[model samples]
Target: MNNKNINRETIIKFNPSQLVNLPVFLLGMILIPGLCLLDDLIKLYLPSGFIPEEIELYIRNLPVYLALLYAIYLGYQILKISCIRYEISPEEFRYYSGILSRKHEFIENYRVKDFSINRPLIYRLFGLGNLTIYTSDKTTPVFKMEAISNPQDIYKTLRGLVEQNRRAKHVFEVD
Candidate 1:
């Protein structure tokens, strides 16, 4: 019945930070250099005539090729994470994600059962955290908003909105 609760405006809309791929990026950083080094070592240690010229060239270039492939994989990871978006409103929580084919999903605020915030050491360093939402919706029982900034504030807002929506709907969790 409250006028404030009647408004369906979005309280928060955010895309997960590209830093979500930090670990992968770091691993790639290490591996790419190591791979290049391995290629050099192969060229130095292997005898000039130990193998056919074509095979020898392929062996020497293998690491460089792998490094290129890993670089491509890293780009894809960053792009996929960037495409994800989350929206919270008084009535529902919406998630949109996809690279080529888009998908949209939502859970009513009243369906939210619990919430948790995880701040890993790396994420804490950047003031980022993941918010996990437990909902009664069958299709999406567990949802995670990963590597988003200021998760605690968003958690509080969503908790309050979920309580208000539940009260308005007279929804009770019997468990």
Candidate 2:
């Protein structure tokens, strides 16, 4: 008999959606191919035997170099997003983020002291904010989630869970 029953269900799971804008992604996809086509059109219209062989070779290969550079940059962007993940469960909040190396951190709900949402001007324009979690945990005292949509809702949900967990654990903050 094999039993894989996970007791806890995820309350919320999210990535950095606000950081990956559809228009920006589409623009990047179009820019390279458009530039290559423009290079081809320029070569076609040029006067007969005007550009020297070395210069022509360099010009013809310029698009390939540009494409390679863009590919490397885009790869980094994809990896940056792929490497970060945030999960909220009833008992704990988890953060996973790294590239080539991996770091996973969990803060129990009872340890969470306070959390706040900060929306800079640009993030406000995009309807996104950063969630900052302050915990009593020694390893990661402050954890931040950037470019998350509707962070206030998440903060309220998290605050409720924290209170519930603290009650269950019989932990009370004394001032």
Candidate 3:
């Protein structure tokens, strides 16, 4: 047994994928444009004077929904900083998060197999990328490790780590 001195270490890192509250983003993207397009249509039916009753009702309702979605997006963005942290202990690589309730996932190093990178069109244009990790057990999935960032470097780093662990295990078996 070797004391690698790699126990109970914490790495506080945040990534852009965390910002991807897809439903919230989608709501904003869809509704704002939709409302704009509906603007003329809304006006058309809006009794051409001090805003029709139905139009006023519709417009009034939009703010509450939009406000709710915006609040969710804002919360995700703001909460990203406090909750985004990963800890690499001697036995487990753990992920920690929570806005209301704390969350964590701790997996042993030997179980990680492959690391992959993915980039959405916007991220690609911005020169940012994403990282995913596949495991040896095939139970856990390739998760978006670090969100929008330089994908190449992270991919290489994680890949190297997984490979290094596998090689070490292989050497021990041979001995």
lDDT winner:
1
TM-score for each predicted model, relative to the true structure = 0.88, 0.68, 0.59
TM-score of 2: 0.68
Q: What's the lDDT for all of these models?
A: 0.88, 0.80, 0.60
Tens digit per residue, CA lDDT, model 1, 60-166: 88897898889899988988998898888998998999999999999999999999999999899999999999999999999998889899988998999999999
Lowest summed lDDT across 10 adjacent residues in model 1 is found at 1-10
Arrange candidates by lDDT, descending. 1, 2, 3
TM-score of 3: 0.59
Of the two candidates 1 and 2, the one with more favorable TM-score, higher being better, is 1
lDDT of 3 by residue, 124-154 (tens): 7767777777765454656556445666855
lDDT of 2 by residue, 45-70 (tens): 75546889888787777777777787
Q: Which pairs of residues collide in candidate 3?
A: none
Candidate 3, residue 100: CA error in Å? 1.5
| Prediction 1 global C-alpha lDDT | 0.88
